[model samples]
Target: MNNLPVQWMAEQSQRGRHLCLILDSTAVPGIHQALLHQLTHEHYRSVYRETAVAALSVGGPFIFSIDSLNPSSLNELLEGQTRDWGWLASIENHSIAILVKHWRERLLIGKRPQQALYRFHDNRVLARALAHLPESAYPEYLGPVISACFWQGEQWATVDNPASGEYPVPDAAQWLATPAPVNQERAILLVNVGQYLLAEHSEDLARLPEALSPRAWLIAQLDLAQRWGWQTPEQLHFLVVERLRETHTPGIKNWEPRPEEHAQAHFERLRGERFPEVKTWR
Candidate 1:
C-alpha cells in the first residue's frame, strides 16, 4: 500500500485541528486503496467513513467517507456542523480553496476540531501555512475571508479560457466582495486585474516587482500582510488553473495554474490607483 508511516498521524494531535479521512476505493485503487484501508484497521488511528452528509449527523473525529466529491459534497462539508477533512490521495482542485477558507473561519470562531487539512500533493505549502499559525483566534476566520476573495479572481482565468469552461465573463463587481469579518484587524480588497486593465489605459499601478501574480495573489497577500503589521487575514488563500493532460474516467487527476505567474500577469494588466503591498510570498 502507498501509505506513509502511522507516526504521520501525530500531526492531528495538535490543538484546534481535526482531520477527516474521505474514503473512496473506486477513486483510488491499487496501493493507494490498500494504504487507506490499513489506516481504517485497528492498528491505524482515528478514522471516519461515511458520506459528508452522513458524517455531519454524528459526533466527529469523523472517519467520513464520500463516494465521490463534487460541489455538492464541498457544500455539505462546509455547511454541515461537523467540519473535518482528511485527504488520502484525493483532493480536488475546485473544492480545496473554498473548504480551506471555511475551515479557517471555523477555527477562528473557537469551534472544536478546528479544521486541519493536508494534501499529499503540496505538503510544502501546507507546512508553510501551518508554521504561521495564529497566535490568537481572531485571524482564523480572516484567513478564509482573504483566501475566498483571491480565489474568485483566479477562477475567472479557468472559467473564461476557451479551452476551459469558456463561460461568459461577468463584471468583476458582480462576482467579488470584500472580506466581511466584523473585527477590522484584517481585511483585504480584491482588485480585479482584468477588469482594471480594461478600464484603465496603462498597468503602471502594478509595476512593482513585489506585486504578486494573480494566481498566487492570496499567498502573497498573506505574506504581505504579515510583514506590514497586518495580522494574517484569517485565511486568505490563492487558486490557479491547469489543463488536464490525460483523461481518467470516474476520477481524473486535477490541476491548477502556477500561483506566482498568475498574480504577476494579472497585476501587469491592471491600471489603477496605487495599492499598498497587502502581503508577501515566500
Candidate 2:
C-alpha cells in the first residue's frame, strides 16, 4: 500500500472532520471487492471506524470514514490495488475537501473523463463544481442530491429520459377550470408548473410524481422565476401552460374558453353534450 500524505491526514484529523474517500474500481478491476474485504475486517475496524463503503459500481467503491486514518498506511493499502484511488475529507455538517492530485486527473465520483479536483461543501456547491467537468462525468444520482440539498425541505425527484408521453403535461386551462377548491386548484396548477420546469431543466423529473408538495413547488417556482427574470408567478404560470399546450396539442390552437365563459351555461353544456369529452379528458 502507498502512503497517503501524512501532513494531510494530520491536518484533517486535527480539524475533527469526517472523511469520505471515493475510489474508482473501473480503473483497477476487482479493487472494490478487495477493498471491501479489507475494510470490513475486524482488524481494520478501528482504523476505519464508522466507515461505510458503497459499491457505486461493480468496481467503484465510495468509502465514508467517521474517523481519520493513518495517511501513510491508508495510501499503502490503496497502492496495493491501484494508485488511482481518490480521497476526500469532510467535516460533518460543514464542507468537503477534495484532493487534487493533478489537473485533469480522474476521480471515482466526479464530473467524467476529466474530473475536476476541488473541494465542495455540499451538493449545491458540488453541482456548480460538476458543471466545470465534462458532462460525461456527471452522475445521475447527483442530480437529485443537488436539488435536495440546494432546496431544503423541498422534495426532489428524478425522471429518467423524460418525454411528454410518459408524464404528460397537465392541461393548464382545464386544470385551473376543474371543479375543485381554490386551494386544491392552486396546488394542482403549482405542481403542473413544477413538472414543466423540471422537464425544461432536466429530463429527470418524469421519474418523480407529476406533482410534489404545492408549497415546495411554489418555492421552486419563485426561485426559478427570479433566476429566469420572470416578474411574477402569473407570468411564470402562463409560460408553463403555453409550453405544455404546445407540446400536448400542437395542431390545436388554444381552444380553451375564456374564464368568463366557464359559468353556469358552460357547466350545463359540459354536463350535457360535452360530458363524454370532459370525462375522457380528466
Estimate TM-scores for all models.
0.20, 0.27
Clashes of 2: 11
Candidate 1, 3: how far from true, in Å? 13
**Backbone clash tally (model 1):** 36
lDDT of 2 by residue, 1-282 (tens): 322334444554666544444443444445445556656432111111121212122322343342434455354434453343333333332222222121112222222221222212222223334434444333322221111111111221211211111122223212112244455334434543453344343333333346654345456645554444554344454434433344433533333434666333443343344224544232
Each candidate: RMSD to true structure? 20.4, 19.4
Residue 128 deviation, candidate 1, in Å?
1.1
Q: Which regions of candidate 1 deviate over 4 angstroms?
A: 1-19, 22-29, 33-121, 137-282
Q: Highest TM-score, which number?
A: 2
- What residue runs in model 2 are displaced by over 4 Å at the alpha carbon? 1-4, 29-31, 41-56, 66-69, 77-82, 93-282
Tell me how far the alpha carbon of residue 118 in candidate 1 is from the true structure, in angstroms, after superposition.
11
Worst 10 residues of 1 by lDDT: 153-162
